[model samples]
Target chain A: MPLYLIGLGLTPDSISLKAINIIKNCSKVFLDAYTSILVSYEEMTKLMTEVLNRNDLIQADRTLVERDAGQILNPAKDSDVAFLVVGDALCATTHSDLYLRAVQEGIQVKVLHNASIINAVAGTGLEIYKFGRTISVPFFEEKWKPVSFITKTIENFQMGMHSLLLMDIKTKELDWKLYMRGIERYQNPRYMSCAVCCQQFVDVLNTDNDADLSVETKQDFEEIRIHAAKAGFSVDSKCVACMRVGTDDQKFIYCSIGEMAKLTEHMGAPLHSLVVLGNIVSDMEQEMLNLWKL
Target chain B: MPLYLIGLGLTPDSISLKAINIIKNCSKVFLDAYTSILVSYEEMTKLMTEVLNRNDLIQADRTLVERDAGQILNPAKDSDVAFLVVGDALCATTHSDLYLRAVQEGIQVKVLHNASIINAVAGTGLEIYKFGRTISVPFFEEKWKPVSFITKTIENFQMGMHSLLLMDIKTKELDWKLYMRGIERYQNPRYMSCAVCCQQFVDVLNTDNDADLSVETKQDFEEIRIHAAKAGFSVDSKCVACMRVGTDDQKFIYCSIGEMAKLTEHMGAPLHSLVVLGNIVSDMEQEMLNLWKL
Candidate 1:
């Protein structure tokens, strides 16, 4: 059986022509959806139906992917079956597990390369190479101390390398899941923002002085930039931010964390996580500097 | 002007019906290729050409993006325009840059959020919150020292965090304006492998012993499981070495990296990089541990 592993790059149009052909021809497709949400299920199902002319949108949530992954690979045991994930194939370990399953069954597997956030974030000119240990800041509980993220951030800071802080994902609606609306998303835990992010960060840092929270002027970091984004594909709408990054639109005007918090009101729709550009904002990243400056 | 920022996610079918509508209805379409290669030019051009019934593809490369991004944005300035990326709009910073640019021009920018590598890698059951900093492993250099990757790697190991190492893509076809395969790819200086990567990492560590390169044994890592995947949304022709990363395939079983190197001749194609499973490789993964003793 032939199994196809894929990586969904950044944008809907970011895929390679070769990948499209494979998916279009595949007999069965199993998507490991929990790793990351490349796009909405409604969009993916429709696209598949239109291209492959197939309506069978197989669903593999965290549970099914963990327990019944072997069953998903059965089609590949004889036919050209496909398993998909966001970013690259091996980018997620779950895909690796699926691969192991296929390998044990003596199935042939081929991986197609595509851009993932691992490199995509480099566009900010943050010197990705200089980034130190990456970590995630999970939503805190009053009882549990989720300080690992703080610990890592400090480690990177002490080494003078930037840190890549990944936020959290709370949901994964299936192919049959209904389309979510703006109001519905707002009702859900929205994507974190720079202003809210910084406040939460400083609050955490203040509690953990090991972070050397005093080193960076709270004023500079507190000057949060809000880049509010929508949840669906917007053809003509540009991504709106507190200030432009990576262009001559560099404006270093600082806004207070409290002032930045105003973004919650001003930001119209669903927001993604905030990229709190730390110690290494470059001169070329003009708008980032401007939005986070005095 | 409404600008649709479509995120292809990782799978070719991950796109939505709404996104297709935007692409088909838009006056002009540009695929932002740099930040992500969500879809290949040939495949998308063929399908989009047929599905959307567009006159032709905008086909913007790095140069156009850098020099004449304005042209791509022209449609968005006054009309409905669409630019697509691999995973999600904010997944890559370049798209954000585009947004900032349009905003400066008083153009309306909209972002369609899809799955991105940043959030997707968590599907592997490797706690999404446990990752450290992300680093890129550049294609080898004879004179230029790229030991930074080694250092970053060690730092992640120290924190017990897995590194999402992205290989450098110095594609000569795009840079030199030539597309030659075979030896041309060699000259192109492309993807990195586990072997070369190990060698470079070792070399980098040898420079500073105090930094401590020795963590878990290579056998332990390879034995645990290695995941090698390329990000691809449009192409299902991808492979992910999920199971038995550290063990042998069929008769060709070798215990250590040293042994694996010896068998490199018969080991089929050169391997892509490996995702050494740190957190998820449980004792259960030890079933493939037999290769470790050989």
Candidate 2:
């Protein structure tokens, strides 16, 4: 009896052959529903069910995964259990903990790695080697607003490296609560868009002065162009549309930070990421960025 | 006609169903041979050939890819061409350039992302968010020995962020040259082992003094522990044996830099990566590293 932490990749069609074979043979299959949302959950489920020729797929919510770990591991001890994740299994630290726990419990675990947003951001034409520590931008609350990510971004900028910002997704907790109350409440999942992230960035810059910067530093920050990429996993095209945002709207073809902050139009769909460019070293990189220029 | 850049993942079994399907339907399939090597090329080829029922697969060497990308793109003008990469397509900047070129030529392109070492290193129990810029450890040449990576690693250490040093792989260049000369040269491909990397690290530290620092910085560098991982893509187990190396043998369970420098043992296989730890942040990371302590 072994636990298989299989990566389902990005799209429905992105599932690997090895993953498919394992899922078909597994006694129980559980999809981790909390970490990050895939582009199309229904299509993924339909594809998995149809390919595996099995129903009764369980959706392991956050509470069940975080609280009741034994429920999954206990079953794994007796039979083959497939715990599927949207991206690569180890991308989220929680999954690594689960793997460690299973190992400690003497339950053999196998990880099937797949594409994650961490590496897929290379689709933006930005060199992956230039990327520094990645950060996540959560929906800010009035009482608990965090601007530490700004400092990290600044550090990366100083070192001539890009910073990838993962926007937040709020799904499972609300869904589980509604389900527990037996109410037919359908609250649409909230995905932080680039527009919202830009606004938040501006808000943090305006309020926070923890970094202790000069007026020139603030001016340099304003001039720095940011990239907003949507649906990086889309198979329709090899390249994803990355919008370059600067401070002056007239300087760039795309929207500036002020414009993006007040933008009403969405980039379309969930799972959008932002990239703050650092020092552009190579001519190729400069050429690629110029192509996206407004 | 369209071109599809497909990531083959870590192991032979890591190939996705979408990749297999696309390969089966592709008019011509070419494997990019130089960027990064998979676990076993023979095993991968066998698995892919058997699954696709095709044996006429071409190996796209570095020259064919970087210098003459037109050879691959020209075929896609009226047919579906599948260009396979070991990890993710965009992980290497060359593939990004290829995608850009294909787009410029009015050739529709699709990228099927897969697991890369960038995200897979999370399995080493090191926090991915705490990793800085990745560097490569190349075999030093007499006339041209570059120690710039050492500077980058030290920069990462200063920021309390880990550095992932990708070991170099030399395969196709020598093979192609030998073939062109009509000489039957059988040189086993060289993979930079952790032992060799450790020796090089010490050699660079002793000779290169680019980072002007005090004696305290040198002492701090000596105390930092490094992790060497091998067979990371093995499907038999989820965990990879990550050996922790410190300055003194008594400080850690694994070998010290001096010990590793003179070690004769090989870590096994072609693909291996080194992780030099930064400042340990959490109790979890400390506990995990302690497990590897002597």
Which is the leading candidate under lDDT? 2
TM-score of every candidate relative to the true structure: 0.56, 0.78
C-alpha lDDT score of every prediction, in listed order: 0.50, 0.65
Error of 1 at B5 (Å): 6.2
- Candidate 2 per-residue lDDT, tens place, A1-294, comes to 889887777765767777888887788888887753662446667887788767667888878887898889998988899998877776765375677688899997777777887887766567888889888888876445565666676667667787887777765335657778897565777888767876766655453652655555545444332221121111111112232211011111223454566654646555667776664447776665565543
Instruction: Supply the TM-score for candidate 1.
Output: 0.56
Model 2 lDDT, residue A162, Cα: 78
Q: Over the stretch B1-294, how does candidate 2's per-residue lDDT look in tens digits? A: 779888877666778777787788888888887754553456666886788767777888878988999889998998999988877877854466787789899997777778887887765556888889988878875445565666677677667787888877766444657878898675778877766776766654452552654465544333332211121111111112232210011112233544555554635444566777664456666555554443
For model 1, how does the per-residue alpha-carbon lDDT over A76-176 read when each residue is reduced to its tens digit? 87788777665555543535566667778888766654545444444443444455544555654333434455455545554555555555544532333
Regions of candidate 2 where Cα sits further than 4 Å from its true position: A39-42, A172-188, A206-259, A291-294, B39-45, B141-145, B172-187, B204-263, B290-294
Tell me candidate 2's fraction of native contacts, as a decimal between 0 and 1.
0.65
Candidate 1: misplaced stretches above 4 Å? A1-142, A159-274, A286-294, B2-20, B26-55, B58-63, B80-100, B109-131, B136-146, B164-294
Q: Which DockQ-derived CAPRI band holds candidate 1?
A: incorrect
